[model samples]
Target: MTAPHVESDQVRTLFSRAMSEMYRAEVPQYGTLVELVDDTNRETLQRHNELRASLERSGDLDRLGVERHGAIRLGSAEELFNSRRVFAVMGMYPVGYYDLSVANVPVHATAFRPIADEALRRNPFRVFTSLLRLELIEDEALRSEAARILAARRIFTPRALELVGIFETEGGLTRQQAEEFVHEALETFRWHGDAKVSLDVYQKLHDAHRLIADVVSFKGPHINHLTPRTLDIDAVQAAMPKRGVTPKAVIEGPPRRNCAILLRQTSFKALDEPIIFTQANAGTHTARFGEIEQRGVALTPKGRALYDKLLGSVRRHVGAEGIGPNAGDYGAELAERFKAFPDDWAELRAQGLAFFRYSATPAGIEASKRRALPSTVDGLIAGGFLHADPIVYEDFLPVSAAGIFQSNLGTDEQQNYTGRSNRAAFEAALGAEVHDEFAMYAQAEQTSLEQALVRLGSPHVARKAIA
Candidate 1:
């Protein structure tokens, strides 16, 4: 008898859980953050029945606790290319390009995640992977040295490469093979205290940029941070101090809203961990941290444009300073500025400001059979024939990500880099094209509407003109 194939979703779920466990063990404070997020989510669900109900109706309730996203920075293209193959085993693909260089950070990134509705519902684990741009380094000698060191070291284990090849050729892994794959893949993200470079070289790279040293000195691209989703980021941010976790001064992204939009994120400061250099010298490195994110609806391009305009207005009012002495005032200004954006779900959909998944309600199914059924989407929704649930944004914002990095790395870590974007080079390194997140959101919304229509009745016959 042929062995039953384990779904990629299941493998992803297993690997995500294992990674959380490993990370929690490595960073005990992360466990506390997780518990706090869990408590916050529970409290939010209790306090907000409508939010809870909407989540239940949309299939987001089950995966809420399991959802997580981790980040890692790779020094070379070879490591990034191999990482794509490893992540494929878990059904994660690169989506959206983030050019941190524009934000004065030297990395360009993509979020590796599951795109399909079913795959996401199963386990929406993601990894924000970044490829270091050595060419951006001003010092040619330092750049060459960094490249040579990165080339000399192999981030992946021999077994992991073997398994990636096996999975690629065979299309899937058996249960045993998958278990082994998880173990080996985990090694790539595991922290190594022993640095590959001497203290002088590390200092040189560190002088260039802390992140550059972080990417080059390490044996592998250690998972820098793992983020757990929270229902209320403000609550968590307020409560982090009480829990002994020091959250960044201001929450990154849009201010709190009745109907959230895009992603709001905050994190405790990166920990200063001790490491041994190649010469048996000891020093400290700062990278790993615990992060919490509260996701909101995926906005359409128009919505995003409005959001960007309003955010810029807030910054203009508040100045270049972010989240410090003026954080409280900045937040108030943000809330005031965002008043221009719609807070109601119906309004958002009507304005084409956000993407939403449409589902046939019991009333809708009953109404579809009637001759007087509404034709337009808005009409059907108004007539209680359809329910539109906001499609949760499953990606990261470049500005928010850069802000988080800056907050952790330090306020002074900012450096001027002229190269704004290199998506072609990033893709060449990643070994595949990054999927368009906006298109993905649009397709999902369309698919959900089509499915709802089909469920109500035949496409041609169901509700003479349903959107």
Candidate 2:
């Protein structure tokens, strides 16, 4: 008898359910993390009417914050393009492209942010995008061999492509049609083929795959980690290790009198899973899946200002240098500067004219002028600054991402370590260009503020009251 076919929508739903189940089964603590986030939001709302009202108007998932998303990458364009069709059936529109090749890390990565608020509401799905690192490998022969293997490997089945084509042409189908499409698409992506391989071949494939497994294993186009923004990530960080959730390094973002914005983070360590490997006997052997590690880097206000200044300065310098009439030169300069000063927050802060902090005392002087300065969030609040609320760092961390991949797969195995991949590759593969992640997040925050004004019935009143 043939297997019972399911619809695309149903397939999407099932996929989501299965993913959540897998995550929960593997990391039961994540469930608690979800609950904690909800509870914290609820309590926050009860304590701060203004914040509650502002968030409510934003049209985001209440208590859940904006939207929960995950990202992953695949090795091929066919998978990337076809995945778009599959996602559409589930009401997920591709939003952005991320290239991790140029990332100052070991692994190549990419991302696709979602567009459907309702689908997100139903189930916060992940965007899996992949990246190819031409620079990781030093041996041209291995690179050639690996590329051939990847090229030959069919990431998506024929049925998946057909369904995607139908969905694209129809835009959307009737509820019944939608259901059918969703089922087929999900099965197509989820189905593990029955192609038989010798133990040696299996092991070789597995080894080659580790080069990009972090991007492939997950259903999405690549391996994308879903980040949940929290005002109290530090609290979560502190509590996580005890709960079996190892805490990676914490990146402190802009320090506000009351809160910190953009605390960069990564998982404390990578976990290893078991994979089947081929042995000399041509029999199957179990091998550790490999460890997945994470890292976190903080960006302070000074860091942000320096980043901005670097862009502006690069623009000015590029124009002076006669690199281009347009802003491309400036952008390239900015990217270069960022790489050079990846962690020069202290140096940036030293340049008082570019980045300075105000004192909390009644004198209203620059903190650097005083003998004492506030270091903690609470301390800043005590100094009379209204403790600006923390903004969720709703973006990927390149180093952390690379670190995770490197941890899972040995980075040293890469054949090429030059000729980096750019963000363009990610865009071309996914067919969805990635934008400034920080800007998108900032817009979300601004939209919430705007909505709050509408709710208040007057922008002036809302501004004054909120201020």
Candidate 3:
């Protein structure tokens, strides 16, 4: 007898339910984490009038809600684009660009970055999508073979397609229809059918499929990870190991010197599971629990500068060359100019110079450094760095993401020497184009500030600030 066919709506419902269930089952300590955040928020409100007032002014935690991060994978651009439509129906949008392909430790793949906190607060769900690079496959025969196999498979069911169509045609479903669709779509993804095979082989295939099905199975698109942010990432990191949850690394973000900024993250290593697969000879086999990897990346000033510079270059180059510039001429000129620079173009752009240059520090540089460190989150707030008002976190750290993925996977394999694909190839596969995460975060923050001003019956106050 064939297994029951699940609808897209059911798949969505089950996906959410299964994710919650899985978290509860695998890392029971996550329950503690959730409770801690709630307790901390409550205690903070009760103990500190200032904090309570600030939260009230900015929008209460109830309004912001609990932040969560999640992970998922897709098989192709079509799936990625279609999934974007589905997420839009639920009120989420693509925010940041992340390149994970260069992450060489263990988990190596490209993905999109974080969503703004406001967007997240409005709806905190964010998924990092990845696609395999067929261009990276050196062996043309293997690449072709894999591509053929992937083309024949269908990751999204008919129901998923229908649901996406509905969401696209109609911004969203009615309350009842929305609930039903969410339920089914979540379920379809979460349901694991019975397929007899060995544990070891099954794991290999699963890992391979994660990489293969993405690119091989329809031009490569898959949700790589779903991530949630917490103010206490450091606390979470410390607690995980104690609870038998082996994290790939410690929290990665700004230094622990007490500052509120873009992001910090850590994750438990991926868990191994047994599975069944068909052999080449039409024989059945089992796969054992294989390795899973994870890793983390912090955005140092240098790193952030690099990131910004790259973005600026892309924008400037795009504007100068136009959308459909001759690839050969454009690449050649850009390469030549880039090579002429001593530092990275992005870094140069960030430093307010076309070349490396730094003025000597004043005589009081040491005394300035010795000033009392900022003790509270509020103390660290500054108009320049922290913004006049609190800004929502946006953007993903690719290094951090690669850290998470690598910590859970097997050893990273060297790419074929004969073929190498760069960041552009990976971005193309994602389908839903990536944007600057920090910019998105800033926009959300500005929106909230305006909203707060309106709520306070002082629209002019916000207008003056903007002016």
Candidate 4:
């Protein structure tokens, strides 16, 4: 006799719920942030009928409430390797290699998330995991010391690793095993007040880089921040102060737009929590914070190139001024430069600037039954037989991520490190190749369009021709 195995989606949902509860308990301010976001989302939905209709049509409305992303920093290759296995049991795979060393953070990252449309619609929980690049540390001695400290510590529970092995040997975990696995896995990300290093060593690492100190000093890589999705991030940003949470100076990612693109994020300041060193020294650490995000349509490569160019212009203007709270006029410059990008959904699609999921309308299905459907996608859409909705962007922005890291790390100095994008090293650490996020989004759009076309026969030409 065999026990029934739990679906990976169910396990992920369970883990996401448990993680939220644990985080809310650990950081009470996060609970308040969540409340503000929930309120804002409801208000946004009530105010925008078109937006609500679009969400319902696209099947995104239900997932919006449960969607969230979390970030964690691992200290070594082995920790990352094992963490990858754990996430796999929940059907999450590493996607998109992001090198944050460009921001002088000394860590490169990948987002572990569900890639399948059904799985994503089920939970859409993401963990933005980063591996510390110790070699980037300028001081040879400190780098070696940091490595030694990381090597000695275990970031995962023994039972979690055992469960992972079991899942790999078998196909999946039984309900009981999965329930236990969620508890054990949660332990790996749980916050610890006790430091693994001495106060003096921590300060030395902190002097080298605040991020280095954070990764090497902690017992485990506690989740730095958990982000809840919001329909209107600017509204949440405005509402933060009223709720007693001070937000970072400017939102990261694109400036506010009528039809939002990519990801827009804002976070309250990181909390200063009490920590006791191994040598009985008492101090405080600022690592965990609350973040809110508004995810919009995934851009096409051409669209992304334009986005990068416009953002580059903004950063060029920001030269030496910094992107922190006091980075004067950064927001104004970003908005002014982004005017080159299209803000209308129809224009974005026609210009091949965004990815969209195409579906057959009820009218289209009825027309197909009578063999009255148009042969071209544009014809069908123009005749109100097919509907196209933007596919959600489910990845992180590198500069936006670094900006959030910098603001929460509470630093005035924008440290510049002498290193470049090392995708090989990041992939080697994880023991797997990272997925191309753009490819993933493209495939999703293509698949949806194909399925809809199948319902009403293939189209000879599509306006965007994702098929």
Candidate 5:
């Protein structure tokens, strides 16, 4: 008898838990961070009843603990192309192209995540996968050597490749195959202390860019960091030092806001682990770290534009006078500048600044059965026939991401490359085009609105509202 097809969401959940367990063992600090987040979340929920209610109503409460995002850097296109297929078995697809090269980080990235609402609710595990840009290295000899070293190593094991092929040929993996796949796939992200190159080669790549060296020197692209979502990042940041974890000087994102926008990230410093090179020479490498994030409502294009403009304005102001060593001054400037953004969810929806999911509450559902119905969405909302809830931001911010990387990698590791964004080249390497995140948000919003109207038995109103 053929084995029943297991749901991809189940596979994703299994893989996510497995990854967390693996990382916790590899880096014990991660376990502490996870505990801190869990404690903070519990306190947040207990202290703020309304916040808890909001999460429960929005179906976010269930996924809070399971929600995690991890980062990994790959050295070659072949690895990236194949990795895409590997993630596909777990129901993750590439979303949002991020060019860290613009920030002079010398790598381009895309977030691989589940797009379906149910899959996300099940386990919104994401991986911020970046591909190293060897060409960015100005030294031709060093760049060629880096490329040759990267090309020589196969990141994925033979068994992992075989499993991925099986999944591709078959629609879904059986439970036995999935269990095997998870174990085999975990090997790629497992830390290997032995470097494939000599200390001299490693030094050259490190000189070009620390990230380049990290990617090219490793036997496999080990999972750099696994981020757990927290309801209160400020609490986590404040408590980090107390818990023996030293957080970065500044939280890398917008200052605190009543309505958090995009993503706010803070991380503990990277661990300096000893490694043995090809010649059995010992040296230290710093890469893996513990990261935490707090996500907020997804902004529309207009909202994002305003946010960018304000962020840029603050950066310019701070840059002109030079940011103080404390970073408190910069945070003050950021918070003051962001006051221009409205905090009220209703005002945001009214101004079309953020995406919202429309649904009929129980009261609204009962009210919709009445013969008198409102034609417009606003009227329906006014009449208690429908409700709009903020859609959680499921993506990332490029500037914030670069900041986290730079903080952990060290300020001295930064190199200025020309602002080169090669989306075409990145996509060409992946063997598939990335899904536009904005488009996905728009679709979700429209779909929610349509569903709400259908629930109200007003298809015509939905057509007019969507129009």
Candidate 6:
């Protein structure tokens, strides 16, 4: 008899649940963050009945509770190449390249996530994985030393590699093998409070860049932070203090909007955990933290360019440091500058600035069975026969990402490595090209529109055939 097998979706759901449990135990504050976000999401849904109905119609309501995104920093190309294979076993493929060099952080990244709508609705778990850029280090000797240390470490367990190879060879894993894979894979992201290098080496790397020290000193890329989705980030940001969690001074990404766009993020400070260095040296490191995210509609390329321009205009006045003293009014300036961008969904869709999933309403289905319905999407909507919901952005924002990293890594002043986006180099290191996020969003919208039209029975085509 054939062995019983579990699908990748089941494996991913199991892994994500296990990962959350481990992180909650390791960082107690994260559990608190989860509770706060859950409460906030509940209240937001309760207060906005329309929003609740929209979420339900689009199959997002069930996902809201299980959605999560985590981050990890790796030290070498070898690590990244293998990490991709490991994630593939969990039904995750990388989408989008994020270069943090512009923000002066010495790393480039991607988000490993499931692309299919059904897979996402099951559990939208993703990992924002970054690889360190040793070339960005000005100190030649320190860079070499960091590289040598990173080469000497194996981030993944022996069994995890074996299982990945097995899955690749057979194209699936048996139930027992799948369970083993999840257990072994979870080890790679587990916290290790011991440093592989000496305190002296760590200090030199830290002096060069806090993030550099973080990537090079650890045995493995521990999941630094796990973010839970929130309906109202502002509510969580305010309530964090009351719950003894200190939020970042400002939230990352666009200001609060009537219809949220792209991604908005905020996190509490990193925890200062003591580490045992080589030969019994005792010191501290701050890397792991709790984060909350609010993801809105994915945008078109035109929408993104406008967002980038407005954000650039505001960030230009702030200090080069992650959070500048001049940035006291950063939030105010951001809101003011973004006024040029429209806030309403109809205007956004009309202007071709955002992506939405179109679907036939119950009335539309009933009317279609009786007689031909309006052929155009606009007409269908006008007649209350169709509806659209903004398809949530499923990727990261590079600037918001860098800001999140710097905020938690305890870096204040950072050099601006402007005009240094090297997607070619990053892709070469990862062994595959990242997916174009805008194209993905556009395709999703078009597919939904076509499917909705099919459900309406293509009235224009039908009338022509009748004549």
Clashing pairs in 1: 375-465
TM-scores, all models, native as reference: 0.96, 0.59, 0.61, 0.97, 0.96, 0.97
- Candidate closer to the true structure by TM-score (higher is better), 3 or 4: 4
If both were scored by lDDT, which would come out higher, candidate 3 or candidate 6? 6
lDDT of 6: 0.89
Question: Of 1 and 6, which scores higher on TM-score?
Answer: 6
* TM-score, predicted candidate 5 vs. hidden true structure: 0.96
Q: Per-residue lDDT of 1-467 in model 5, one digit per residue for the tens? A: 99987888888888989999999999999999999999999999999997887788678899999899999999889999999999999999999999886566888999999998878888999999999887788998888888888889998889989988988888889999999999999999999999999999888887777888899998899999999999999999999999999998778777787887888999998999999999889999989999999999899888999898988787667741123343457778888999999888878888888888888777777766785787888888878778787788998887788877877776445467648888999999999999988888888889988988888888788342221
Q: In model 4, what are the clashing residue pairs, if there are any?
A: none
Whole-model lDDT values for every prediction? 0.88, 0.43, 0.42, 0.89, 0.86, 0.89
Off by over 4 Å in 4: 320-326, 459-463
Candidate 5: the clashing residue pairs are none
lDDT of 5 at 370: 82
Q: Candidate 1 on 1-467: residue-level lDDT in tens? A: 75666788988988999999999999999999999999999999999998998898889999999999999999889988988988999999999999988667899999999999989988999999999999889999999999999999888889988988888888888898888989988998998899999999999999999889999998999898889999999999999999888888789899898999999999999998999999899999998999999999999988989998998787667743364445558878988888889999988987889999888889878776775566676677888877899999999987788888888876556577736699999999988999999999988888788888777763543332212
For candidate 6, the 10 contiguous residues with the lowest summed lDDT are: 458-467
Candidate 1 TM-score, C-alpha based: 0.96
Query: 1-467 in candidate 4: lDDT tens per residue?
Result: 99988999999999999999999999999999899989999999999999998889888999998998999999899998998999999999999999887666778999999999889988999999998888788799998999899989998889999999999999899999999999999998899999999999999999988888999998899999999999999999998999999998789999999999999999988999999999799999999999999999999898999998999787777642255453688888888999999999888988889999989898988888898877777788888888989889999988789889888999755566636788998888899999998898888888888888888765444645542
Total backbone collisions for each predicted model:
1, 48, 78, 0, 0, 0
Which of candidates 1 and 4 reaches a greater TM-score? 4
lDDT of each residue in 1-467, candidate 6, tens digit only = 97977889899999999999999999999999999999999999999998998899889999999999999999898999999999999999989998888888889999999989899999999999999988888889998999899999999999999999999999989999999999999999999999999999999999999999999998999999999999999999999999999998889999999999999999998999999999899999999999999999988888888999989999897643247777888888888999999999888887888889888899999999987677677778889988989999999988898898889887875776667788898888889998888778777787787788778876342211100
